[model samples]
Target: MKKLVVMGGGIGGVASAYELKQAVGSDHEIILVSDNPWFEFTPSNPWVAVNWRKPDAIRVDLDEAMSRRGIRFIHDPVVRVRPADDQLDLSSGTVLDYDMLVIATGPRLAFDEIEGLGPEGFTSSVCKTDHAAATAQVVEKLCEAPGPVVIGAAQGASCYGPAYEYAFILETELRRRKVRDRVPMTFVTPEPYIGHFGLDGVGDTKGLMESELRERHIKWLTNHRIDRVESGVMHVTGVKPDGSDAESSTLEFAHSMILPAFTGIDAVMGIDGLSNPRGFIPVDEFQRNPTYANVYAVGVCVAIPPVGKTPLPVGVPKTGFMIESMVTAAVGNIALALAGEEPRHRATWNALCLADFGDRGVAFLAVPQIPPRNTNWSSSGKWVHLAKVAIEKYYLHKVRKGTTEPFYEKFGMKLMGAGKLRGQA
Candidate 1:
């Protein structure tokens, strides 16, 4: 049997493993390795931090889930990857070999790059479950004090959705508690504009987000680079239109949350020919690593360049649906190769974002993910909130049930009024 090893047990990794099992059936041996056995539903993390959702409601037992689908699970962190030898050194002093390797390891937070940042100091993050819990406690204390709040993403940060979500959620929470007047909220981001969102303003997102921020009385600072975060104060230097230093400003806050930039995971960073200088793996249009034919990557770990240049940082946004599409394509190709059949690539990814706005929500759709034409659309409504809730519940159920079917694929097709995917023979 062909042996397949998948690293990381997050959403991307788990989804890939499940899809691999479905594609190859019981013919191949699949092993998933991760430091943690439990998979956290990352998208719901914002809610978890604010007491809207519980921790247990978003976590799942990966071992049980994968075992039921005939995939082996190892709760161990990968220390090093000897890609040339097809072996991996685990932190527990064990080495494992694989015929094929799938790198779904997510991005690593680079908090140390900034001065006086991270958990030890003034700001907090909602990127992880632990961070969220910690931030929740801090937020509770801040609620009692009722002071200034600052929220936004740091330099080179690609995942801007969470930052925006946290900002709006906090705004909504303050309104709910009737403390909106007591707290002065500010949104600071490295994005050149209000809603660049790393993908270069998707379908009026720029206008819509700016309008919403203004309506909510949320002050924003754009094209700003944070030099250091001190006690209750953030020092920022805004970039001029010509990309030069414009002016320096210092903003004080009682509580702050800033999303740090992400780099490639440590293991994959040291591998030659497998990753870029930025440590992101380079994959073909089909999501297969060019240098290592048997290696595939998905999610934020894959190196995709920015859509356009902005005064501030701009990056490609990898939504959940996009990640799912990549995983599906990779799994199908690998399964075909294992079955001694010619591999074919036939999957396209699009962006679907549902931004929650305190009492309501806004939705955006970008067919074919890339810009410069195609069907691009966006809308705002309360139903967007309902749809988000439904998606969360559906995903949680699937994770608990250990199913491999691509829910996003079905949902995307339904939205586009397209036909079903062609099943493998």
Candidate 2:
């Protein structure tokens, strides 16, 4: 039997593993390697940072879940990847060889890109479950002693949805505690505008997000690059449209959560053409690495260029929906390769997001994640918040049950009507 290995345990990795197993069944051996033993629902991380959801509520024990599907689970960190040899070296002195390797290891948080950033430094983060749990305690302390709050993404940071969600979620929480009036909030981002989101304002996100921030009285500084952070203060340099520095300012805060930039994991970095300069895996349309045919990648670790130019660097976001599309296409192509056939599947990189505030939220659907799309729509309401809550639970359930079905294709098609996706590349 051919042995196939999948790395990482995030949405992309887990989905790829399950789908691969279903495609080949017991005909081939499938193994999933992860640094951690549990699969944390990452989208729920913002809520965890505020104690809205406990850590346990969103994590699935990977070992138990994978065992039920007859997939071997390895809980060891990868030290290095020898793509040419089709081998992986683990931190525990174990070596693995595979006929096919799917690298779904998510991006490494580049907190060190800025001084005094991330959980180890001055600011808090909601990128990981552990980080979120720790940040939740900080949130409690902030509520007891209210002051200024600074929230936003740092320079080169791609993911902006959670930053926006955290800003509003915290605002809603503080209001519930009756301390919001005393806490002055400010949002600082590298995007040229409030909702650039790396896809250049998908579905009127610019107008909707700006309106939300204005109504909530959250002051903002767009096109701003964080220079550094000290205790209770952040130094920022404002950028002009010509990619030049304009003004310098310092923001004082009692609490702050800044999303840092992302890079590929150390194991896969600087491996010839396997990864980009920033270490993100470069994939063809079929999600297979161009230099290494057997190497497929998905999720945030995969590299895609920014949608447009801006004052500062902005990376494209691989939303959950887009990642699911990648996983589906990768699995299909792998199955074709196993059967000695040419690969033909290509994933549709659509973007779907449910950005939740505590009381309400916004939903965005872009038929194609990039601009010049066929369908671009966005709406906001309490229903959006409720839908996100339901999705979190459903996604966790899917993981636990080892379901291989793609979630986004059906959901997006129904949400936008079937006609939007018909006759597209």
Best-fitting candidate, scored by TM-score: 2
Candidate 1: lDDT of 69? 80
Query: Model 2 RMSD to the real structure?
Result: 2.0
Tens digit of per-residue lDDT, candidate 2, span 77-122: 9999999999999999999999999999998999999999999999
Q: What is the lDDT of residue 127 in candidate 2?
A: 95
* Model 2 bad stretches (over 4 Å): 417-425
Candidate 1's error at 53, in angstroms?
A: 1.1
Listed in order, each prediction's TM-score against the native is: 0.95, 0.98
Q: After superposition, how far is residue 301 of candidate 2 from its true place, in Å?
A: 0.7
Report lDDT per candidate.
0.83, 0.92
Q: Write the per-residue lDDT of candidate 1 for residues 1-425, one digit (tens) a residue.
A: 88899998987899888888777758889899998878998888888778888788888998888888888999999988888898999999999999998999888888887997777777998888878888888888888899999899888888887888888888899888888899999999889888888877777888888888898899999998889999999999999766788999999999999988888888888778898877898998778889988888988898988887777766777888888888888888898778777668745777777787656777776777778647566666677678778888999888778787778766665655632212200
Name the weakest run of 10 consecutive residues (lDDT summed) in model 2.
Answer: 416-425
State the local distance difference test value for candidate 2.
0.92
